[model samples]
Target: MTVPKGKLIIIGGAVDMGSNISAQENILQPNYIKFFEQGILKRIITESAHHEASKVEVITTASQIPELVSTEYISAFNHLGVNHINILDIRTREDASNPEYLQRIRKADVVMFSGGDQLRLSAIFGGTEFLQILKQRYQKDNFVIAGTSAGAAAAATHMIYRGSSNEALIKGHVQITAGLGFIDSVFVDTHFVQRGRIGRLLYAVASNPGILGIGLGEDAGLLITEGSMMEAIGSGLIILVDGRNMVETNIYDVEIGAPVSIENLKVHVMSIYDKYDLLQHKLLIKKVVKVENGVFIKADK
Candidate 1:
């Protein structure tokens, strides 16, 4: 398989785009706005080929309130000194085929999908000319594709369309579907730690151990380069569920709605700056060094 030259950034939910908080609160607490602005969004701009000069296209097709999402993204990008930004308000399959929209996608250096219903993304853009062009650019050019929340969930080949967090461990609770296919053999779940979504992601991987499961915590993200090297980013944690070495699992024997049993499922927890090799299934930890009174202290191995 040919390696993709482009990059993919998948972020967890609840990225502060300055739209959630009131203007009064933002004025009073300036640091609150700076947190996300200086963090993930800044990283997105920096990863692009031209940085601030890159033309970014924000697709809000999955969102119910596309106008609001569009406004928030526009404001956020503008704050980061990105003037070349366009919001693609594609709601229907017909909209996905618009000549103008397709032309804009061709010119964009970076494409971002906002948080919403992942199903909408797959349903609307599937088998469309727009998706074809996007895939082609990602394969041939150094394009950047970024998504958060539902957008993140849909970036993989397999997606969890429906699954309640509380009863996720129950058999048949998690529903899997075909996604955008930007990444293969991986299932992504967002708002991981906050929502207690490990069970669902585990179920996903247990159903198919060949596929690696990634659980992204809120405000956390993975910067995937060449579709193999994944570098963790942001403030929260990243969970990797590897089921390749499973000793036993009764998932196939268990009936629907029954509690399944599994043994020896391997899991890895990662933090900011940590790296994971997707193709090799290896983990590379970053060493932490502390300074104390002009003395440098290395963390114990």
Candidate 2:
């Protein structure tokens, strides 16, 4: 089967929720305190075709405060001058099968999932026709799927539900479950740095070394194209934990709650504009300039 080249915008939360200012007033304001100042929203807008006419649907199923989440996105999209935005208030599995909701999913150019509990999303949408349609649309059309925090974490087949940053290296500290299965070979963890999730991500990699661990920092995100090529964007770092070269791991043998041991796991830290090739399991280095002793210098030969 030929796979479609759909786009995914995965964000680590804390994107402008700190705003005390009004959304309408902050439309063009570039102040640091304002929302959408982090360029992630703009990047999302640019990814959609015919920005002015594209229909964007916001799915608030993961959020406990669905109304608040929906309103924020609505305001942000409006500020970005995008018309035809809809909010899918799908709170239950029954709602997931609603024809009206299914039709909305059919016509949307971009479907965004808000941050909340990832479990809520899986429980509500699992095995539903709505989810099947969404997956079909993603696999066969020029569609875009965006998610933040929990939303981002649930985009993969194996999801991190409960994991402690403090005790992440312990054998039983990290808990993972099945997700929406959008991407199967990658395990995603959001609010990476802010929540001190590196240890947890490493533990996940140690246990399931076959997959890649993506630790997304707050206000940071990656724009994935053609399923496997990811370009980093936003203000923070994208930490990739690659275990393809791992030499040893004690996770399987260690008793539950015991500290786990791992060796030779590869780690990659990327900044804005960095790109990664998942198909080849390689980082694509870019030719750029460097600063040497207060002098700008070219790094590319």
Q: Candidates' lDDT values, in order?
A: 0.85, 0.80
Instruction: Please list the Cα RMSD from the true structure of every candidate, rounded to 1 decimal place.
Output: 4.3, 4.8
Candidate 1 lDDT over 1-301, as tens digits, reads: 8899999999886665655531111122322322454567788899998999999999988777777677778888898999999999999999999999999999999999988789999999888999989888888898999998888999998999899999998999999999998999899999899789999999988899989999998778999999899988776789999999988889999899999888888999987678999889999887658745432233433
Task: Please give, for residues 1-301, the per-residue lDDT of candidate 2 as tens digits.
Answer: 3455678899887665334421221223322423253468778878886665789998888877777667778777787788788999988898889999999889898998888889998889888898898888888888889888888999999999997799999888799998988877899998798779999899988888999999998778899988888988776778999998999988889899899889999999876677898888878655448744432233322
TM-score of 1: 0.91
- Those runs of model 2 whose alpha carbons end farther than 4 Å from true positions after fitting are 17-38, 287-301
Please report the candidate that would top TM-score against the real structure: 1
Backbone clashes, each candidate: 0, 0
Clash pairs (backbone) in predicted model 1: none
Model 1 segments more than 4 A misplaced: 18-34, 290-301
Clashing pairs in 2: none
